[model samples]
Target chain A: MTISEIVKDILSKAEIKNIFFVACGGSRAACWPAKFFLETEAKHMATTLFTSNEFVHATPVSCNDHSIVVACSLRGTPETVEALRVGRERGAYTVAFTGDPAFLGDPDYALARAGKYMVPYRNSDKLSCLEGNSVKLFQFAVELLHQAEGYSGYQDVQKGLTVLDDVIAAARQKAGPLAQKFVNAYERKDTIYVIGSGPSFGTAYAFSICSLMEISWIHSPTVHAGEYFHGPFETTGPDLPVLLLKNEGATRALDERADRFLAQYDGGHQVLDAQELCMDAIPEKVRGYFNGFVLGSVLSDYLNLLGKARRHDRSVRRYMWQVAY
Target chain B: MTISEIVKDILSKAEIKNIFFVACGGSRAACWPAKFFLETEAKHMATTLFTSNEFVHATPVSCNDHSIVVACSLRGTPETVEALRVGRERGAYTVAFTGDPAFLGDPDYALARAGKYMVPYRNSDKLSCLEGNSVKLFQFAVELLHQAEGYSGYQDVQKGLTVLDDVIAAARQKAGPLAQKFVNAYERKDTIYVIGSGPSFGTAYAFSICSLMEISWIHSPTVHAGEYFHGPFETTGPDLPVLLLKNEGATRALDERADRFLAQYDGGHQVLDAQELCMDAIPEKVRGYFNGFVLGSVLSDYLNLLGKARRHDRSVRRYMWQVAY
Candidate 1:
């Protein structure tokens, strides 16, 4: 079934009073946009995003038959599978986004097929994480909002989805040269503070841990732009390498505030404002929602360049999947 | 009014459908236990924790007359005051936990008196953050649970609270020597990864950003223990400095897993297990709930010793209140 059809059918049968977005790492970060969208748009419906194991260990008291649990894993993460199982046990309408059945049949994915509704998203040699994971999960949210509330932004979301690929391409092209410049100047720097706010903070978080740390072996820590002044801003210095992202969201002012602070205190900092991306193709009404897509794509460009300059393969890992973690 | 009396009065007049815990920095971290408690025990009411600015910028759609907004700050953070004002404008019942009225009357706190209900919490020369902030916030939660749901664990919570002070003192004594050893060995290291899960994660977060970074000028980033294996564990190595906290909550296994990995791969990591703390005075049933209090007190010892060793006064700051963004 199409995402719309699946959501419509589920809405017809169950009164989903709450949503639990469960995953880990990048997938957990990806859950942010959907949770933010629902929190902002969906009245009377509560939503939460949780790390998979935390979800399983301390399952929300509200996770009942009336809850919808969306669990994501690129290749059947064990905790995600268990989290889905826990959701199912609680009689929640459970959805899983994972690799193909053939991949799930591997020993590593022994219990991956736990979702009541399995939505297979491919992960191959190439990196299509944004397209495969975040976009698909967001489609679920869009479909849910449409079917449940006759959300007026449905058309805007559809238009955004249609032009999103082109927007991502444009962003990648625009960011490529800038990323190369960044790599040339700051190639030896070990620590970078990646900052953003609202929905864009998800991308900043993903880039810091998944890309900079895991992929490029750089010590990058994420700080929410709104949260920067609270405590993390104290660590800022003249030589601090800060990568700040700005998006045209309601919380854009927070990101701009952090950017302004970094501009004053930090010399080795870069600002990747979503305004620089060619998002004219996306509808103006919903451009804010698609900023994550643009930011994720552009940050991927930066990470790829940094990885290449440091002679590190993005796929290379010393502990992940190789060791019995 | 006392916390119990205040919660009782609030409950008497209105039916609160949801709770929003709004704050920034350490105050925001203090909201976790209350939010966690509601998520775990409250069957119908929903709860969310938000950074104050984000709460103001993208207010939740559910913030209606039936919503309870609990805003926290030591001396009225500007964003927090704005957040409470937004909550009040939305017709939600607004509560504030700020400093005494005299301190709040200063020019810096011009807009601090935004909440419909103001609860004074003190911040004197000594460090009483856990007591003045987290403990008070948690009292509101405990009273809320007892009043709203007639929670059977009320007596356990009461017993736990009665012994919490002693538990904290015992934890401090036990942790002081270990912290001195830790400071002697790893004081020069600039980066430390602080890890925890469940409610205890709040303490880890507070210690990392508020104590380590803001107070001691050390580079510390927080990682949830459940989130460690997903991507962050890849960044762990032999020479890395890791400060891991373990609690008796349902998510303790996650912390133990991260602790095991650190033990094997890193020799410099220090583990502060709640089980080691003298929590025997607290009720056995609610011991897990007070682990955060014990952990916070013990971690404060570590941070204090480290601050002394580095010759960095905990009060020293380059940008906090000295500069404007």
Candidate 2:
């Protein structure tokens, strides 16, 4: 069956509430998106846990016959496999979605089924790596949500999928221009601070360095929201370029408040967000797979591209230090 | 009564099995060691939570009137106080550990009746920041455990109290020599990979950067003992510095097995339990916290002092991002 059909099947057996969505990294990175999406679409939060974050002290949520462990693995990673085995041993129903059925347990029927479908589309057909496969699995979850709710918003979800592609394209296109802008304007700036909260935080981390500072070879700090109050609030100055990730989701309000505080930060250099900028052109309905991370990357990529006029190099990041303890 | 007495009295009257400790940042950091020390001494563990970490979705651990909530404060942080109020509403016993007792509550009767002991000696004060207070609280908990368990190794806990200081002194002493070593040896190293698991994982993270590299400006990455079999295995190379945090609290067998696999890791380094190094010298209970972090810090700090020889400047790191949806 298609991944979406499989999700719908699981939900039907879930008795409207038996599914447990396990997670590790933020869903935006494309590993798992159902946690936030389904919770918003349904009454139950559906339970979430970083695959590796289990505690022997005591488990707040149980994995048993009454539950379904829907684990997502892009490469059929060993840890993910072990986690599924753990759930099964606890008497829980288990279903795994992966691009590598061989790496997955050879449960003949499931193996033949997942290999014939999920892998061909996400791995071979698209030539996507584990990362791309992660995105597709998340896409599958989003598709299933559309079927169960019959929300008539399936098209919106499809558009959201397209938006991810658009964002990636936009990142590449804007890289050069933004690099020049940073060079001509904020080139000599001492320290740039990138800030965001929730799922958007990871995107901010990768882009601030990989896209902007790395591309431009500029030094910067990416911070968590509300952290400015702790001590970094003092780092604001006339020469600082602060990139605030403004996205709409559960954290929109807090993000706005953070933006408000950051606006007054550092003598007011450059502050960009949804309401204050023209990101409407970016696309919407980011219900799956770091869809926003893709969108936000465009801004950082553009900033870095624009900054290169001043001799910044994208490949050159402050030597990524490996601290040996 | 003193801080120690107040904590002890609060424990005597409470059924800690159901207690849940809640606080924020440094305050939460201050209390966790207490839970570990107390649990080991009391032969039980209390449920612990950090407010900021719960901003997304927190595990709703079970608790009731028989439970106690110990809120810690440094300048009466808002979240810690708020958590205490929440606990009271939930029918849980409440306590507050703070630098300023006046801000703990209105009448301060319960607060004042406890922790009243005096230490008039001017030099008797324990340091309160940068994990100083954390160490003091932990050592005191060890002392409390010794008293409760009738452990004859009270002096060992006493020695444990000074381990950090001793490590610090050692760190300072080798600052010159190790700096030169790290400068010459790691001049080409780029990334740091830190690895440890179980209770030590927290400390592994603490030292991975804050206690290790941050103290010395080295780059490090920490992982669980077995996690090396996952994606990190692919990332391991000569360009990285993999610091294995070997400890005894969990299981020596698992650690030994991990040691067998280190030959493939190009950036591999080992931090054997200091219990063996200082076995006859220090007490068993005292060996837990002192050997890894402090000694690692000493080593890393020594490396930092050699920054000039390496010709590379390092900056302390801050929380850069989170996954935003």
Q: DockQ for each candidate?
A: 0.76, 0.06
lDDT of candidate 1 at residue A11, scale 0 to 100: 91
Compared with the true structure, what per-residue lDDT tens digits does model 1 show for residues A1-325? 7677778778988988889999999988877778778887887788889999999998987899999999888777888889999999999988987655555323454334687776666543244544466778888987897788778888988888887777778788888777887788678887777898888888998988898778777777688887789888898998788888898768889988888888889867888888888888887876787778788877777877788888988889989989997
Q: Write the per-residue lDDT of candidate 2 for residues B197-217, one digit (tens) a residue.
A: 544554555544443333334
Scoring only chain A, what TM-score does candidate 1 earn?
0.94
Model 1, position B5, has a per-residue lDDT of 77
What DockQ does model 1 achieve? 0.76
- CAPRI accuracy category, model 1: medium
Q: Interface RMSDs of all predictions?
A: 1.0, 9.8
Tens-place lDDT digits, model 2, residues A106-161: 33434223222232224321232323544555555566556545545567666655
C-alpha lDDT (0 to 100) for residue A262 of candidate 1: 85
TM-score of chain A of each: 0.94, 0.62
RMSD of 2: 9.8
